[model samples]
Target: MLVLPALFDEANKLRRLTVEVMQRLDAAGIDSALPDLPGCNESRQPLDAQSLDHWRACAMAAAAHFSATHVLTLRGGVLAAPPEMPGWNYAPVAGRQVLRSMLRARTIAAREAGREETIEALQQLGRREGVELAGWPLGAKLFAQLEDAAPQPDSAQVEIDQGTIGGGGLWLRAEPDEAPEQADTLAAAVAMGISTV
Candidate 1:
């Protein structure tokens, strides 16, 4: 299985959870890989230079490279799943919602700083010279690509929700931390879903 991570904070905050899930999967004899997408991780390619289509293509290539039979997506990572591969989604999110939240925060900050940054201007700037949105350098194509992108429709796969695992959303925590319980729960859910196949 190929483990596709969520964007930004959702991905960073769940780093420990990903590690925990991987350990559990290993114990269950379910092998998986968490490959870094192009322009992400240690890649020299600047984030703003990458288009969403490029990421999608990279995902498909990674799946092939790993010879993965299934994908395990977390949150907005659902957008990267290759259609040909079967997969499971956990807390899928729409990219548009995420972008909107980022833009809103940026707009609010600009207002307080007495800067005139409108959404349209930012969109235009992003398309022209790459703009930083919520700390991520977004290329115009990528920003436009995600504007209407929703989670890939359920494709005969499983979707797990760890909300009841307690302590609210781990991604929302002010400080970085781990949710061992949630990780275990997620691992079990993943294992169970894979077992059915």
Candidate 2:
């Protein structure tokens, strides 16, 4: 299994949960690997030079390199999942939805600073040069790509709802957190799913 984490700040918030899930999977004797996407984690690539297409390609390469037979995507990570791979998407989110949340945060911060900013204006700027949202610098190409990005439908993939995991999404929290129950439920679900496959 290849684990793809949530994007940007959500990734930070859900890191612990992802790790917990991986640990559980390992305990279940299910081998899994998490690859650092280009421009993310310890990768040396600059975020400003990465686009969604590039990330998708990198994900595919990672899956191949890991010899993964399955994938698990979380939140916005679903946008980059290899189309042909059998997998589970945990709380899938659209790219536009992710950008909107970030843009809203930027606008709120601008207001807090006694400066006016609008989502339209920020988007315009993002589509021109680039824009930084929640500390992530997004290139114009990447920003534009995100405007229409969504998970591609694949018959081989199964959608996993948050309710099925028995907890609120860690990504929705203001800070990083972990839920053992959620991790246990998710890992067990994946283990069972893989067994049937």
Candidate 3:
């Protein structure tokens, strides 16, 4: 097994690089099983609300499934694992994911707050909160790619009629099938080493 931060918590405590690593391992014909920590991802609980022992249980669950495991910790602390196959903290995917999560949460908040018209709030976010406290310039580049940040999917993509300060902008048209992606932010954040600017 390979260890990393839980990426897709909505699903489970996903070892993001595991599948990719497994593919490499499989090319060499190695096998592995990755499981989620309890109260996270697919386990169906609130990780932010879970206890350390609960997290330990999660790792133990992983242990029960896999005979061997290699845990690589992101952030400063390595997620506790059973004294199994070499566990250690490597680099930081936290910065990248954290930024993306914040940005997404902010976007969602703005969209929900604005409902039909969230662009104004977003632009302000680009102005005020965009830079963050660390003096990073998280300007238009991060969210500019989004079609629009409107809440409803059935809504129009953009509302460009007249008197729009930044010229005509794209309305956030709703697409029931589409959600959001971190690839852009991941690339952008990774380029900045998880920091925003």
TM-score of each model, in listed order: 0.89, 0.97, 0.39
- How does candidate 2 score on lDDT? 0.92
Clashes of each: 0, 0, 14
Off by over 4 Å in 1: 127-129, 154-156, 164-167
lDDT of 2 by residue, 1-197 (tens): 99999999999999988999999999999889998888988889999999999999989999999999999999999988987899899999999999999999999999999999999999999999999998999999999999999887753789899989876889899878888899889899999999997
lDDT (0 to 1) per candidate: 0.78, 0.92, 0.36
- Scored against the true structure, residue 85 in model 2 reaches a CA lDDT of 94
Q: Highest TM-score, which number?
A: 2
Q: Tell me the tens digit of each residue's lDDT in model 3 across 116-184.
A: 434455456654434331122343333232223111212211111213222221112122121123222
Mark the 10 consecutive residues where model 2 has the least summed lDDT: 150-159
lDDT of 3 at 171: 15
| Local accuracy of candidate 1 as per-residue lDDT tens digits, 58-122 | 89899888888889888778777776578788787888877777787799888999987888788
On TM-score, who's better, 1 or 3?
A: 1
- Model 3 gets an lDDT of 0.36
**In terms of lDDT, which candidate is stronger, 1 or 3?**
1
- Sorting all predicted structures by TM-score, with the top scorer first, yields 2, 1, 3
RMSD per model, one decimal: 2.0, 0.9, 16.9
